[model samples]
Target: MATEFEMKEIKSGDPEAARHSSMAAPQKSVTVKFENLNYSVSIKAKKTVTEKVILNNVSGMFKPGKFTAIMGNSGSGKTSLLNAGAVKGGKISGDLIINGEKMDTKFMKKMSAFVMQDDVILGTMTVREAITMSALLRLPPEIPKSEKLDRVDEIISMLRLDKAQNTVIGSTRVKGVSGGERKRTGNLIIFKIPAMAMEMVTNPSIILLDEPTSGLDSFTAYSVCTTLSDLAEQGRTVVATIHQPSSDIFLIFDDLLLLSEGRVAYYGPSSAVIDYFTKIDYPFPDYVNPADFIFMHILNNSEEAKQADKKKDALNKVLLEWDNSENKKVMLNTPATQKGLPADVMKVNASFYEQFRFLLTRAGKNVWRNALMVRARLGQAVFLGILLGLVYRDVSSRPLKSQTQALGIFLASVFEDVQVALFLAPMLIMPMMVFSGFLINNNNIPVYFNWIKYLSPIKYGFTAAAKNEFQGLVMTDQFGSLTGEKVLDDLAFTDELPVDQNLYVLLSMFIILIGMAYMALWRATKKVV
Candidate 1:
């Protein structure tokens, strides 16, 4: 199994230390297994909170040297289960035993690369740069830099991305790598922006992807799956959530985990699924594609439900059949144990200067390359500034504008607080929903909590929006012309701060939030060295 990317270590001529380091010194094989994993989230609506169950009693194992696909119709908790295995955290309860130890976000982040479905790698860098920079940042520093770059080159070759090495992970706006090449980087691309797609270049032994093949051609999707298969060959635990793959793409996955209504309907080898379904009384026709047949005939909760409603009883029966079958026993009976490499492989090794230099360079490039961002932001400022200028320019006239100012840095710092923002970002932003003004009147809130309105950027932004929409103008009706001032007074916006004050608040908050974000990142990088 030794290749250009791997090397033999000779440490004091000691066999035990070499065994502990495993393959070499940086990357080691990982086995991730979980059982009784139940995940749910509390969703708040108009006036009530409800728990939405995503994964129920889901038990599965993604072993090293296996390309596993978790497939189900929309809302089958495929993404949920993958995130669980990634240990990104949710209202999840289970034993996620990695290398025979129950790990946390810190350790998992060290040993795994999670490519979310959206907002993947930075779109500005070239394919080689993305992978190379990721290696420089995440690989153990004890290894020489040249060897790290060599490993990156090996990965690029494995992914067949060497031909597209210089290509920019482009977006719909910027010309860059092809869709297939982007997906092949072993990362997720949202079809609009090109992703760095070099999640594999890190020391992370485990890789979790959500729809890496989404938005690609059938051949490209198959090719991406094949790249994952190659990673399995390299002894990495590869797990991804795929949707409605073609027969060829389906054939590429060594194992399959099918879910329906937050429950495990099937979990086993991809080739065995047809036999399993056939044995459960749902016969597969000779010419029909098993995937399509399973979706329409077996899973009543699938997006493509036809007579699936009538098949609800039948779906329950199928679930029961799988639950009671020996396949479930085999899946649960797989030994949950393994040998782990040294702890150095489970930590990011980079100097603060290195991280800052890379980040600043990336940001500078992003700003320089993306002229539209600057131009659009300038256009918005000009328009909003002119709008307020045309108004009486009263200190009490306009109000809160949230998204344009400090929200990103504020939310980023908050997300960094928890260290895992996969699902936590939205969860952290839940307070915004309550404070958004339109959802609840500021007056109705209790006096002790009423001061929070001062902190709610939505209040100020909505006031400005309301003022811009209704102030200084008149509405004409069949009865008479009503002054916009009357409408503003009626909405109680007259009591709020004016355009000038709102700008000051947002500007100050933006400045402060930026400082906070900088400190948060600085402290984080301060430890890496």
Candidate 2:
């Protein structure tokens, strides 16, 4: 019987294996190497500030065609190491090399895919729609839409998600796909290792996952591990910070970097870890799971101060042993030299306009499918419109009292629409509307509170509505009657601005608010390293 590695080797040599490869884009080899990496964060207590070291002198290499698992106890800096290595923004000091060359943050962001633990997916979209939209946005603009869609289908089939391809990804408030499928949707490459191996639409050289098997059952965890292993076998460099994995799952990793309190306890092939510990006179008992034993041995002794000190000494011995080991000397001591990388791999294919158009189309589809949210918004708009129409019926030809009522209703409607669309909270809307000139006379407002009217959307709405309504109308007020101009003067709406000018101001505010909302959504849904 052939081992898993032997089977992978056989598959690589088989000509038929190419048939299963992705046809969407060509795959490129990526090697990620980090040396003497250290990360720290500053914390302030009262007037004094202190820097907390998160990752201390961490170093490792992730090569193409291999899966590296970083395991550690809670607060062991596994995540810190992963983040530092991704070239993301932080207080990190290290030498990070990609494909034997020092790459910039922009290159890393463009060429790599980082899948965080929490699944960030649009609940309104179906499995196919989400993946298809991602392909459209991430793939090079030169790739045809048809070809990009073919890649989506290939990824769906490769990940064994064909059954749920059209199923909606439901959220807590909505009903949709399963947790496993949701996780798969978050990382397209690992979800469909075969398709990624053949040719992914994005064609990322390196992939990083933070706790890919977290919140999964034994069987599901095993399946996820198998998929990651398959991704590594296809010549992609895969690195993941895993939680407590089962014994069977642990064996699937090609390399292991065990960390304890931001320090390396062991770093080498997974098969050699047990032997390394045994050589230090710490051997696993008969029939004991090596992964469980390793963690237990490292952390089990850290309960009391004396035991913790002893455990620290033991851990240091292992770290020192690894430092002197032949594997470490060969893998870590050699400095990486610059190598030419593929132009396509480093280039971002899509233009800003293309990304915006694709995002807009996807957002429109999401809104369309989210029937409950759509109905709610439409219902509010229609209800408010009808209510305003009834309250201010025929005010264009009515007396001053009716016209004033009409102005109030119109102002309220505008403010309400803007509030509902932008803030999405009545708590915030009510206060802003109260301070607006419609409900309270601007002259009577306190000096400090007078600034609120200028910043309030309701003030702009009321001003615009009043100007449009009373511009040239005749009114019947206390002095037997007055022109709309006189009424505007009495109400202190004497800005001398034209109706079109006020409308333009309102339109500008609306555009600004919409832009802010878009930025918020982008930040919330964006990938985190």
lDDT of candidates 1 onward, in order: 0.67, 0.71
Which residue pairs collide, candidate 2? 21-198, 22-198, 22-199
Candidate 1: count the clashes.
Answer: 10
| Candidate 2 ranges beyond 4 A from true positions | 1-27, 42-50, 187-200, 301-309, 323-326, 334-338, 393-407, 410-456, 476-479, 512-529
Top-scoring candidate (lDDT): 2
Candidate 1 lDDT by residue in tens digits, 303-340 = 34475565777888887887788888887778744665
How much lDDT does candidate 1 score?
0.67
Judged by TM-score, which candidate is best?
2
lDDT of 2 by residue, 295-387 (tens): 888544466765687887777777777667777768786553325565765555678998888888887987887888899989989987897
TM-score (all chains, Cα) for each model: 0.66, 0.82
